[model samples]
Target: MKTTTIRTDLPREEKRKGAFMILTFFGIMATAGFLAMSIDLGVVAVFKVRMQNVADAAALAAAQEISIALDEISDQISSGNVQGEVQDANSYAQDQARVMAEHVAELNGMFIDPQIDVLFGQRTLDENSGEATITWGVSPFNAVKVIVRKDNPSQTAPDAKVDLFFAKMFDNDQVALRAEAVAYIDSRDLVVVMDFSGSMVYDSLWRSDSIDKLGQQAIDDGLYNIWTDLDSPTYGNMQFDNDWITIPSDSSSSPKVSLTWKKSTVDITTTKQLDYARLYFSDNKYQNFSSLSGQSKTLSGTGSNSGKLIKYAKVRYKENGREYYADFDLFDYDTLKRGLDLNGVNYPYPSGSWNSFISYCLNDSEVNRAGYRYQFGMMNLVHYWLDAQMPYSSTPELWKTRHYPFNAVKSGGSLLCEFLDGLDFGDHLGLVTYDTYHRVESQLVPDGWVSESVDIGATPITDDYSAIDTIQKHKQAAHYYNTTNVGGGLHEAIKLLDEHSRYGSQKTILLMTDGNANTSDNNWSVPSDFSWNAMTDYNGDGVADYTTSDSHKLYTFVRVKQAIDKGYTIHTMSVGANADRDFMKAIAFAGDGIWVDVPGGTTVAAMEEQMLQAFARIAANVPPPKLTHSESP
Candidate 1:
């Protein structure tokens, strides 16, 4: 120990030992630095983990909120009535977005201005593609990549990736949410009513080049095409004019014809109240005008006496098993060229008419030769044709016919006598006149010749007699006025149609018209003093009680309401410009039907195609109503 102390004093010489000490100190410092780095790295790792968890939660929360928002959006869109309201949708959507964003921000302790930026809605979903798009706002980072798609996660991938912190590098972060959805709108119910009336026949104006400047080819072609396709057995067809007639493809089959006269009469009155019933319900103006407009709310006398009488005669002809003519008979080339000389009122006949008329007797060519006039058996053939083509009372006016002028003769003008003569009574067909006019004899000719035995009575006799007399009188009044009543035809046809229909089958209606309701001196009721320019007889007295304020509008209201009440999905088409577009539109709007306006300037082929397309559209949109046993009843 004494020797060591002596050496320590001498170490003052060893003061140059600074290098070794420095080395030792530096090594200690290096180790401390390594430890400090390990601690800092650990802290960074923890922060990363926390950030990831927040991102996951935020994304999922946004996704769910968006889904709810979509549901709200859909409800809002469909909430408004047909009038169409929209701002409500935007408000609801934005509210939902804010709530979702706030909740996410609270959980993560991150600042965010969560909201939805409503954009103009201009896009429509591609239903076939199953795709939708939506626009939204961005916050914090200004922009980010995201896919806003439908909520059907089932269609999404399980390992989908969503970046939450990528935008954080810009010192800004915000949860952006989006979603898309689709809802279906449907309109599906249909009813079709087809018109089968006498006016469907070709008139001289529809044929003559002089009067019919537009040409007959169009009408002829269109009608032919339409009729051929409509003749299918799968659909319902009725032949109606002032009455209902069933033209069976198979003569032996029970014709699917409804006797509207009887049915309508029965619907309004029974045997006991016939005479006591308000022979005049509402005043004449109201009652008559109402009937003409297809309203007839008061249900005056049973069926129109004229309609019933026609039906009676038709039934007789049917019972006798007579044959009627097809519509094409009046247009044979030869018969058409021969021209009609109705007391010097020369009129060109359509070639097809003559051909059609002859179709009842010999082959179609019998009337093809130039100046060919089949007079020998023409009356018999015409009678056969008349019997076969009996019209229904409710047939649409477009389908009815009145004065069928053949060979332009003043004769062959009276359809009433022709109707009765076609019956099994042979020449006794004139007996109906006898019943009405009290005739002892039955010899009446078209040339104003009456076999003394056929002309007996003067005063009106049976109702049937009176009805025929009306037809005769109409035939003599206005040449064209004698044309058929189409609405009446449809009414009759519908009645007959019910017979063949059973419950559960689809019921459809297809109505075709050439013009509006027939207008005659505006007298829907008996010609009275007040109704010379009045509308209705509300008092039920025979006088004109109601004046037409909006009678024209009433036409649409009545027709549409009637169709709707019957549970029919109506489809209406105008044959030409002759129809009232406004009225047609009203009818279509009220019944949810289609209004097809046949172009006036277009070619017949084009017009027909367009009409058919319209028909197809109607057929596509509406499913027929399911027939019920009560529907027929």
Candidate 2:
């Protein structure tokens, strides 16, 4: 009965069940096989990727090492060639490669038990090429190879590799990793331009708006801060009206060594001599007396001008207890300070203190000279200042000239006056203004000293502008404000820099101005003929022609030549809405200098920071070479 009933229907269910069993067996087997394949594939991929990474890193490391070694080798070879030594260049190259490889491997992580194989592939009379191979195994059966080919005259890529774990299952060969890199030796000597301007002044100001300095002690501290922050021993500084005092006297002064008033006496040998003149007031003029009587008087003369007295004073210094007064018969409006000395002899007056205390009446000879008339006032002040500043020493003989003390004095004027006037203008004026323009001729831009001449001839101000009144005007303004022609100052700096370059010493020029350079083409001209384009070859061809343009005229060749002649580098920082950005950039480019924008005006801290950064950057660029090692084959 059951068997009879289950015949056909049971046959269908049983057949279906049988089919399911067969399908499940096949599915299970397929799933297991697929998972096994995936696991193996994943393992192979990870190993391949890891090995490739090692190869790439090793190759890069090897290439970098090779590059550095090659640079040293090249230098050594060049040195040998210069000495006419026939060296085995091939041996040198192999040694370098092996050393580089080993050193690189040491720097790598401990996980990479890398093996380096270096080979001297080929060589020529003046060139060589080599290969550095790095190999590391991921597993017992997996390996990666990286090749770094360093060729002379031309370098090749760094090769890297990645391997599949089971790739070797198909063939008994391990996978290869590939990566490439190329490198070359830098053959140019880097030239640095550092900023050494007094605006780099770090001290806080009392009336930051006025020259009446309050916290000089604070200023001294700031200055020391600045001094300490200066990165390089090699630098040039310019203080608008002070002497160019260099620091570290042993360093070369070829490129117009410019330091400010704080430099030691031994630093800058040259000084802006102060003007000295014996000013005489007639007894009548000194005591409300009228016109001077035309007369001849005799007195003594000493030192270089030592001779018989040709003139005499009608009055002498009278001691009225606490105050010393000169007795003159007449003190009149027309009467001006006269140049007379201890001998009572009238002498040509220069600015700064006159050594002689003798007073004298004005002779006809005094009024006869044209220059003596207008300069008489300045002459008197110079004599007074020098007497107060350097009371002990006998005035130097150079003071006799019209530009004496101003040309001879070491540190001249107050710091406020110098920065306000313009750093370049101050340096050019140097001892001239400080000493009161005694030996002006000596300060004349020397002939081969500069690479170019600044056409300051077009300047309207041929007369000395170092008067206390004039200086006071600048000192009263913000450090970043300018009431004068910055263009002229920049141009002057260039010419001066060129002059310093001639002495086989490098120079750096720093200029800071509040206003843009004069855009007046009518009054200014770039001295192209005498200008040295610093961006070009020192001999003058790598850059474009230096031209005169109203927009770009301020820091043209005339100004830059001074730095170029002395192998100087110039750095300029400024504050002003009208400041010439393009011109500043050009000056920076030409002088190998930098131009910084003091966004918040020229604050003592901001200016100092900018200058410090510039100095550090320069120092970094010229850092001395350091030694490192690598593997070799």
Candidate 3:
């Protein structure tokens, strides 16, 4: 017992230190466990987000496929192929949905192995309560619900499983992830009314060969002969005089052929050529004929030579070692002379006709081949650009027929088809065209309307392929016609939308034109004087109406107001320089829509881009989704 208590105290102190060390070690182990758990949670969260994205894409794919299946079912029923049985239709829809989901999922990511569940149904939301409900197995099968799950034991095979890195320490090696999406075939009634006016037949630029050189040579050689034929007492009153005509030294640059004549009794050899030629006619004498140099006029009028005049005039002349031909207006020269004299300055002398005739000739052969033709206006550019974008599959026959001559191209109708080809599933499209009259090229129908009959202008079908096929076929057959009837086109489009569009669907009209409302037939009630018949009634009231006039513009405006009042959106596109941009803008403004102006002289690529952007904007402006219910539970 001698000092042993002291030794016991030291041992007790060592034991206490050991106990403290054990507590510290345990605390460290607990902290590390929590850190591992956090890291595992972060990894799981990343996988979960990725899986959700995959599921979203897969669900969309499945919904689209189901929509297509519904279209097939409708076709079968319409064709008397499918008997009265819902199971067969549902089975086909389920199979297609599963297949499409797996395909899209595989494309999105490699780690996503999902089980897709599809339900054909309708989703409704109570406006008063803000509550949404889904009714399954609904008739018409306009909606599809897609559930995508990974590692869900209750789901079918090929469930998605994500491996754990740090959570394995807690005896968890993997985690299951799931997501879902629902989609409905939004019934969209769209009308695409394009211009098929006579201008559409022209190319963007004409070839240099379009000039009628042979006709121009005849004019140059026969102009004086015609003067000789106009016999009168005043013809010889000025007396016959010495005259000499000198061809221009540099016709390409100067474009002037000097004509000098002397009436005075002077030495003919000493008389100098007049600095400027003057033509003495009945009441007026035209001076400074050089002013006529380089002018171009389209040859057209009521005359025996009208056919010859409508094409072009070529004034052939020789300058330095090159032979050149210039464009000139030969037919109706008297009328042209009067028009040029209206200003009372810059008169067209008889010599000025030659000078003016040669003014437009570019001596450079390359320029002649590549120079832009004025007759081929902005509308042609739009058509050419659209033609360039068409697929080879759709262009073979068109190219051989329409595009081969003068390197001409198809119209904007093809571009509309190309756009339709890229549309999302469940979008419905209709086609219309306007010239002298509005023609229904194709009726409004869902994304899948591919019966052969549909392609041949029959009513829209509910087949297995894309509605774009029917639209494209119709567009290919479109041809240029005389006159622009925007009112008629819009009227037909609105009527189609009003009559055939499904309830609760988005309605749109795409009105395109290259010109103002200049043409009106008996159908539109516009008088021959191009004036609005103010007394005609538009609203069916017996009284003569002042509110609805009878001009093409008033008719179009009335239709636009009606469509707007009915909640229809209209998008207007002015395609060419002739297109009345202000009119189009007003129409779009009235309809609460957008106006797209592709002005003249822009590149083809620019035209295409503008058109595509307009369509994209309209598509994006759809009403917000009615109800999107997630299948999380």
Candidate 4:
């Protein structure tokens, strides 16, 4: 501003430029503040999301623990623990649930204090709207709720702060956020289908499946000296004994063994015709067989109205002057093959050395030193494969009943009941056993049902589900060791679920079997009462799965589809090698359920454990946990 040019306008223009500069500076500061606020908000939003996930996870973890706790309580109850003990178990489960939630929170980088509430309660679902309402502090807590948050000064839970990433300039350096979640399981009604067939009670030694590798074990245990058909992949014989029937001082009288070949349980009066009988003896090791060198005897009575003794003889067993268990041998339809055909009683048969007949399956020489007691033990496992029910025992050991597959069935069934008893879910359990027909052993009722004893006259299968005591009830129910009728069994189970299940509750069928489903028009056919009807278009094709054929009329897999159509899921367990695994698996798939295959163990305890674990898995089976409430509280 030169004095000569100095003017008010010039001064005013300079002032305007200064004003613009100040305004621009202020605008820049405001824009920076807004950007910082956005970043802080974004960080907080992302953090809240992360915390929400942690809450959801913690809730689910705790809920899973709830299931385990239920199982524990169930176990204690099943083990005959008293009410006070059961309460203790429940308390333990509740504590463990909290522990699990905290563990999960820690895993997700959350450090929630123990004082923070991990709520246990009940959750109910709306059938029409599918909306769920949660009620906290309910008994038999079935639902779990979890909460999480960043540190807060006023909170009872541990306090900690999360500094904002960009809002510090305004004097606010921290942010607060919280999240909550809830989870639960629905109730269920279960019907158990079991098989009680005669084969279940058959001798394990007669098991033809590769699973029964008892040959080596038997040899090691020094029980058998001769195998009827050695190393054969399929056969129903493998029972032998060491005691040789003493040849009565009179040689003409043969030591005869009688076999009962009638099934009393069969509806029809039928008898088996004995085609032929074979008597085996250890010629080389006569420790069990009396050496009858140069001896001969005649067997007279097989003692069957429809059976006949074709021909029987005993002669000197000298292998070209080689003296064995006897100086002579038995030459008949069932004796040593001596080409010479010395005895007049000697008829046409497989001719060769005494070893010739059994050469293919021969494996038992030094049985005395093979171990065990008195040169042999655990014998008498022979039964005629060519016929039914004809068991040829050389001694009194035949009277000892051997329960192979049936024993496994009862043992495993008991274990299943034990598992169910532990749930404490108040879930109803019913039992349906099928042999020639179906019998409802226990109805779907609560435990400690006094009506089981008093009201039994109304129905034979009116026993209540007495928690673990159901084991004995199961044993008694499974007493019918006759022929299998899987279809009839399934039908009865389905009927039970259909008629007695609670409304709005989950319905399930647990079918356990030891062999193939009994088909029609064969030796395995069930009685007329076992007739079963089926209905299902399992493949979704236009054609129905159930047809007029016997196979279709039987439950087969159509029953699984039928159950599914009725909103009932089916889980199957196949016990022993004889169980029809493929069919059972197909049923499980169709019914939207699971299948478990358990081995037919040698010992009852071993089989019991396997069966118990299997049942446990089935009992614990549940849909994946979902977030009923996933929001900030």
Candidate 5:
């Protein structure tokens, strides 16, 4: 504006300031562009992670559904509810798997229906190579692979993609992503080492609070129960001493001598006996007479109505005269038909005082051939629980052949099959029972025997398992007697797994007992000079090394360690109060397994409940579904 008094220094300063302003503007523009690019990249990265999470979650859900559906199909095959094979089951499982995957994907912020691919197959381990191989579209489909993606369209929705928040300016707003997973229902091998000791079948109340009144007592050191009129010495309704009776043939006279008795108090040397005259016709009618009184004359049809004969009477005898004159039963039932069995024993029962207590076992219904399960719980009476279609009747000394606890064990084993079926995986099961002798009933059997005929070693049939356990259990339970050799049982179980277990599968020993370890390999009858507390080697060679309780317990641990050393878990179960608790817990601890003790209550219901729960826990002991692999689709 006004004067032209310009200096050379002022012009130079103005030029420098202009250069500084231009450099600052360029640096600010470059920084803003870089910040925008970084923000767009961050948005894409975050959404990519979220899409991968959704895919993984969806794949897991699909695999889980497939596993559950396969389980249902197996159940249907077992119960004969549906006549379908594993391939048929796979069809349904895959379909539902797709649905489950979509549902899960949606739940995890995937608003669109994502592309899901589900495939059913079997995952097997190569025995020689020790590697797992997945084969698709197999018969026993136990493995499922799921692939979830956002790039493909579904029937109800368009393609799904991870949207970028800050990349819109660059016209790159979305990214396609996918995930995959393979879940295998892994296989397991279990050997049920059960206790079949004689004590397993004791009377339900044998261990009760008020056992004196109704419970059965074990005799011969818990080997058997005679149940010899245990209520009292003065029991009621004994069989008539039929040696005195001379039954006539059917074609006897009109006033036929069908049955007869005479009065002679000789060997039956009770003081005041029979009255020989107090006869009962039935519950409604009875009258006293002296025809069968004095010398020898209680003849047929004496002191009785025509059609209704003497059903019961009291004769005081069969005693060593140590107690009072207690009168017991005399009867005219069909059991008194006076015949010998093929074994030369009395046909219906034994002779005289042994049959003296038979009437106490007989109820009003059994006396009439009606049914026998209600009265006194038919204690040692008849085995028919209310129906004639039930198994064989209860006979003296036949509690081993027919009872509830052993039957409960068999049924409980069947329940294990049910649980195994629920696993939807192929499994092998074996059996070993220990009493005085430990016998292997069956070798490893597959849970899904796909063949028409059941054959072990690789085939499986829940029915296959069912049939084997059925036949073997009955055969072995018939001999549930003598001592408990837990060591021997574990030894057998370990051998079974060692020989039959499949490679890349779990080998497990489920050792069950209702008693302590008593019988070592040797059945000791004579006491050898050995310490009762030490783990003794009687012969000093290490075979049959256990001679006492402590030694037997240690020997059991030694057997358990064989499986442990081979990478197997030993799960211990105790089914009764008398079971060896400390040893069971210790062995389980040593093998890094679980110890479960189910209280053996005093009834069949309780036994059933205990075994069911115990096996259920054992079933749960399997490792959770094997997440075999996860990867990009």
Candidate 6:
């Protein structure tokens, strides 16, 4: 009591200092409280940002999964494997979407179960506001919507709570967050135009049997059998079938062979037996011998001994105890052997046997005639080589037989089928082949679209598999033909896409060829007057004037331009050496698409691989599903 009595009499300065301390203590407490509130808000803000990021990822993942699920269901329905119900399909897609969302959310630090929602539908433009609104229960089921939530109290399984540090002083333990995203799959209509021209059948390894035999002989003999002296003036007389007529030495004109007499060294009394006989001939025809009396006389010999009888006239001579014969045709022996002597055709003495000589001339002539003229037709060495490589029945018509290298079209078609198998469900595909004419093998239909024509009991196409099956059947039935009609194929492709493609879908043409446009007329479906250039009104009078005819390339260019104007993109692929790269590139450029060149290879397998790679590349380049919207609602 005594110590507290004098406290009120302190100086004014001291009292003021004490009051300031009390106010400062209250102010410090207030500042701490405010700091704690800010900490809490900062923690909540960070958590919201993190949760929003997670929601975006989850939504995108869920949307993609839903799209895939819907595609599977559509494929099943189109394949006839299942009669798809919109409700069941949507339910399945939603389940997939939820699973994907939860999985993605968990990957992004969401430990507790996150709230997820999915919708399968279409996005349509609002006519009034020009805004897009997602509408559910639409045919084709091309759209998906996903919503992800964190710590949402309304959700049965809310997202994991975001713990607070400094905010704990304020009793704020966690925060709630949510995000939504919408995704849609765009429809694509694609047409594939293939070229099946005559050149498509060309194979470098293709040879005839005759050529092979001659080539083998040349290899064995170490000499090229081709006649190099064919231009020689005496070459015609060397022919085995040439008629040789020689006149006796006494005949006027000129003697082809002159006679000379020599005294016999051993028998001087009998004199050399007409040592050598000489004969003369006019031109290549036989000249009658005129005796010393100026009377015409013919000398002939008969014998079945194997010898090439060049001329009808023959001369006989006696030596020792044997009689020998010589034909007037033998007079040309010196000239014939002049060039052939180096090879093996040897004419020994004038009385030598002609057996070997005859055989050599006949074989040489056969090889020369057949090899130089390519007279082996389909059975030439090329054919023989092809046969050895690819065995088949030795049918009369070899070209008609299907073989490895010749099956390029089939291989290409098979690759196309493989590509088709990978197409997204709901994408429409059309097939067309061009030669002298263009044929629509298959009309544009959804990737899941199927027909009883392909498989009677097959389930409607519900997915890409059935669509691929349909395409496979068409490919199998396709056959190669003669001319390349690019314009006709393009025309048919456009018609098919226009007739069967759904509105608002992407239209594309996959044009493949091994050659340039070779046909001028569009004889597929259009009339003659409306064929190619005839259909274009160049003067702008709206009337097709046939004044100037258009080339195949120009006509095809026009068609490509028209298709491009109609919102069609053309992707062109060239195969083999004959393919026109520039032309195809031009078409692709005009159509606003890509151009692929599938180079030829040394081997059939290599070629097939190149083709497969080309097709795969094209498939990969196909327009992918674009996300029109990727934001939370």
C-alpha RMSD of each candidate structure in angstroms? 28.9, 22.2, 22.5, 16.5, 14.2, 19.5
Kindly report which residue stretches of model 1 are placed more than 4 angstroms away from their true locations once superposed. Answer: 1-182, 185-187, 203-511, 519-556, 559-571, 589-594, 599-607, 617-633
Q: In model 3, what lDDT does residue 88 have?
A: 56
Candidate 2 vs. true structure, TM-score: 0.28
- Top candidate on TM-score is 5
Write candidate 6's Cα lDDT for 54-168 as tens digits.
7566656766664455445432232212223333554566666777777887787763243326555655433223244556656344465555556654334545555666666
Model 6 CA deviation exceeding 4 Å by range: 1-147, 152-175, 182-187, 204-406, 422-424, 442-481, 522-550, 628-633
Error of 5 at 501 (Å): 0.8
* Candidate with better TM-score, 1 vs 5: 5
Candidate 1 local lDDT, 146-243, one digit each (tens): 12311223323321222234334434232323332211111111122322223323232233321253454443333333333323111112121112
Candidates in order, TM-scores: namely 0.28, 0.28, 0.38, 0.51, 0.54, 0.45
lDDT of 5 by residue, 209-260 (tens): 2133223332111211223322211112222211233333232222222223
lDDT of 2 at 471: 26
Residue lDDT tens for model 2, 124-177:
011012222212221110012233322222112232233334444445223343
Candidate 5, superposed: residue stretches over 4 Å from native: 1-146, 152-175, 204-404, 421-423, 443-463, 476-481, 522-549, 630-633
Scored against the true structure, residue 541 in model 4 reaches a CA lDDT of 62
TM-score of 5: 0.54
lDDT, residue 465, candidate 4: 45
lDDT of 4 by residue, 213-276 (tens): 3343532222222222222121112124432212111223333222211111001010221122
Ranking by TM-score: 5, 4, 6, 3, 2, 1
